[model samples]
Target: MGSDALSPEVAARERTLDDLRRRMASVPGRGESATGHIPREQPLRRDLLPVPGPLAELLPDGGLPKGAVVAYSGAHSMLSGLLAAVTGDGGHAAVVGLPRLGLLAAAEMGAQLSRLAVIADPGPDPAEVAAVLLDGLDLVVLGLGDLAVPPARCRVLAARARNRGATLVVAGGTWTNPSLRLDTRVTGYRGLGAGRGRLRSVCLDVRVSAKAGPPRHGRIDLCAQAGRTEWLAREAETREVVDLREAVS
Candidate 1:
C-alpha cells in the first residue's frame, strides 16, 4: 500500500524515519571512509561519546563507546545522567518507550532538550523504532520492559548502531552479549539532616563489567540544586581509626 493510504500513525512514523535519514545525510564523517563505506576502526574521539565525569571513570575508555550496545540496569537516574551528558555535549539522542523519563531532571543536568527526542510509546516494537533512530541520532536508548528480545535481533541492532556510529543503550530487558553491562543502586543520600533540610543529592554505587576486563566499582553523587545538576565522584569507602591498646587490655 502507498504511504498516502496508510493510517495517520503509520504515516507519522514514516515521516519521522525520513527526517532522520535526511539529517544523517547532511552530517559529515560519521565513521565513513572516502569510498562511502563505514570504517571499522574509527578515530579515538569518533569511536566514543562523552559521558558524565563520574560515570566515565567506570568505563574502560572513559566514555560510552560508539558503535556498541551497552546494557544498563539499576537506578533510572543513571540513564537520565547519560542522556544529559550526551545531549549537553552537543550530540543528538533519543529515548524509546520511556514515558516517565524526567526530561526536567535531564534539563537540570545540562541536557540540550532541543537535541533530544522522546518517543513515549513506540507502538509495541520499540526495537524497531530504536533501529530507525540509530540511523541519525548519536545515542539511542531502548526500554525493553519484560520482553526478551532474541539474540539474533540484538545482533542486528548492534551492527546497525556500529555502521551508523551511534551508541545503543538497552534497559530493563534480557539482551544477550552487549559490549558492556552496568548495574547501579542507591547507596545513600545527602543534604537532609535533623528533619529540617531539603533533599539535595543521592549517592549511587555503580558496577561496570565489560567483555574483556574484571568488573570495576565506584560511587557517585548526583547533586541537584539551584536549577542545575552535577555528577561528582565519591570515595568508595570511609576509613576509621582503631586503637589496639583497648582491645589488648
Candidate 2:
C-alpha cells in the first residue's frame, strides 16, 4: 500500500479523510478524538430560569426548565406573571394569537418591554407563527383561544420546543402530555374595603401539577404597585384582617 503504488481511487479517499480530520481538529472542545462530537454539557449548561415569587414554590427546581411544555387555564394574570418572570431575565417572549393579552400588565409585573413580542390575532392559524418564534425566543406562549388545538399540533410544537430549548406555554385551550399543568382562579381580593378604594392585591387559587407528581393547591396573593409586582404574605392571627376585597366603582 505504498503511496507511489496506490490506485487513484485509494489516494483520493486518503486525501478526503485527511481533510475531514483537519476540519474536526480545528473545532473547539476538550475531546480526544479529532471530531469528538463534543460533550452534551455544552447545551445543558444553560441554567434554568427562575420563576416569579408566587409560583416559584410550585415548580420542581423553583425555576422553569428549558424545553418545558406547559398548559394553563383560568386566571389570565397568572399567565402574564409567568411571562414576566421569563422575560424579566432578558429572555425574549412571544405571545402568539392572543389578541387580548394585557401587554401593559406584563410590563408592570417586571417583564422587559423590549424583549416582549405580541403577534396578536395571528391570521387563521398560529401554529406556524409559534414554530417560528420558538426558533428565536426563549419563551413562546401560544394562545389557542376558544378553539381546541389538535393533539398533532401540540406534539409538533412540543417537538419544536424541545429541539430549540424553548419553553412552550399554552393558554385558552387544553393540551396533552404537558410537562406541567396549571389551574388558577381569582378566589378573592385584598388591600381594598369599599367600592371607592384603590385596588391592591389579587388572591389566586393556584393548583399546580406535573407529569410525575400529584396536584397541589395553594393560595397566592399578588400585589402590583408603581409598575412592579410582589407576593404578599398573609397577616398573622393577632393582626386585624385586612380584607382582600376588590375595589369597584
Candidate 3:
C-alpha cells in the first residue's frame, strides 16, 4: 500500500524504520549503500598513505605516515619511485621548483601523470605557494633550490601538514627539523659500458637518519630496464632485509 494511504501510527513506524536504516547505512566502515558513503568524521585512528612494498621498510611506520615531513637529498630517482605509489593509486601529487625533474622517468617509474602537478618554478616565495597547496594536495614535493626556509616557517608548515593529514616532502635539500632524512649517493651504475651504452640502472647507497627514530643504512636499485622490478632489494640474497635493518640499528 502507498505510504499516503497508511494509518498515522503505521506511517510513523515506517518512518522510524527508514530513519534507522539511514543511520545504519551512514555508519562508516559498516557497509556502503547505493546513494553514497557517509564517511567517519571523528575516527579515533587514522591510516597512513600507501607505499611500495620494497620501500615500505624505509618508513618507520611501514607506510608513509601522514602529517610527516621527509627530506630527500640527492635521491631524485628514489623520490620519483616513491611518488609513483601515491600518484598511480589516485592520489594527487605536486612538484614545485624542480625544473630538471625527469617527468618522463617519473612515468616510467609508474606515476600517473594525469594526477600529478608540476609548478617547475614558484617565484621568490616558494614556501608561500606550498602553503596554499597544502590545503588540498595529498602530497607536496618542494625543491629546496638554495632557498633557505626559516625555522619558524618550517614549524608552521609541519603543523599544517599534521592537521591536514598530508605529507610535506622536501627534495634537493634539507630543513631545520625534518622527521626523516635520506642521503643518497650513487655507489655504482650498471647496464652501461665504456661510453658505448645507455644508462640502464643505478645502485644507490642511502643512509637513513631520522629525528624520531633510529638510524639505518641500505642499498636501493633504480633500474630503467624493461619490466623493472623492486627498486629496493638487499644485495645479499642470503641475508634478509629485516636482519640487515636490525644489524644496522
Candidate 4:
C-alpha cells in the first residue's frame, strides 16, 4: 500500500493532505494533544474560543462557540478583531479568500501573526479549503466573496466544523442557518474638528443574534493612538458641550 503504487490522482491527494498536516504542525502552540483529537468526554474547557473584550460581553456564551458556524456582516474591522482575539489567545487560525484583510491592523489589535495562516486566494472553491482548515485550526474565517453557497454545502461544512471541534466564521455571500450572527455598523468617528483634525477613533454599533432568544445590541469604540488599538467602552449619549468663546477666555 505504498504511495508509489497508487494512481496519480490519489497520490496527489495524499501529498496535499500531508502538506496540510505539516503546515498545521508548524503553527505555534499546536501540540499533539491540541490537534482536534481530544475525546468528547474529556473535562477540558474547549467549548468556546475567546473573543475581544467588548464582543465577549455581547455573546451569550461569553465568547465564540466552538463547533459552530457564525455569520458576520458589516465592517472588516470586526473580522480583524476576531482573528486578533483568537490568535492572541494562543489559538491557531486561518483566513481564506480575504486578500485585502489588513494584517497590520490585526497586529496592532494584538494578533499573533506567527500562529495565523492566510490563504488570500483559496482556488476556485474556498469553502473546500475552509473545511480542510477546520480539521486543524481553532478558527477558520471563510470569505464567500460572490459565490452563493448551497444550503447543503453549508450544512456539510458546519457539520465538519462540529465534528472537528472548530469554529467557522463566514463573511459575505449567504449562509443557511448559522448558529450566531454578528452585524456591525459604523455609527460615527471621533476626534474631528470641523473636518480639520485627524481621525482618532471609530464607533461601531454591533448586534448579536443567536438561534434562539432575543438579540443583544451594544456599541463599541475602536481607538487607534500611540501605535496601538484599544477597544473602549461605549460612549455616553449625553456630553458636556464647551462653548468656544468660554474655552478661549
**Largest lDDT belongs to which candidate?**
4
| Model 3 misplaced regions, further than 4 Å | 1-46, 194-196, 227-230, 237-249
Against the hidden reference, what TM-scores do the models get?
Answer: 0.81, 0.74, 0.72, 0.81
* Clashing residue pairs, backbone N/CA/C < 3 A, model 3: none
Task: Please report, in order, the local distance difference test score of every candidate based on alpha carbons.
Answer: 0.81, 0.69, 0.67, 0.81
Off by over 4 Å in 4: 1-18, 25-45, 194-196, 238-249
Candidate 1 clashing pairs, residues 3+ apart or interchain: none
Listed per candidate, the RMSD to the true structure in angstroms reads 7.8, 13.7, 15.9, 6.8
What lDDT is reached at residue 188 by model 2?
67
lDDT of 1 by residue, 127-204 (tens): 988988888778988998888989999889999988888999999989999999999987666645545356577778
TM-score attained by model 1: 0.81
lDDT, candidate 4, 1-249, per-residue tens:
775598876666566656777876665443223464422332225688878889888999888889999998889899999999877777789999999999999999999897789989776677877887888888999999878899999899999999988999999989999999999987777666454466677778899999889999998888898988998768577322233343334
Candidate 1 whole-model C-alpha lDDT, 0 to 1: 0.81
The candidate, 1 or 2, that scores higher on lDDT is 1
Give lDDT: candidate 3, residue 163.
Answer: 86
lDDT of 2 by residue, 62-84 (tens): 76677888888888787788788
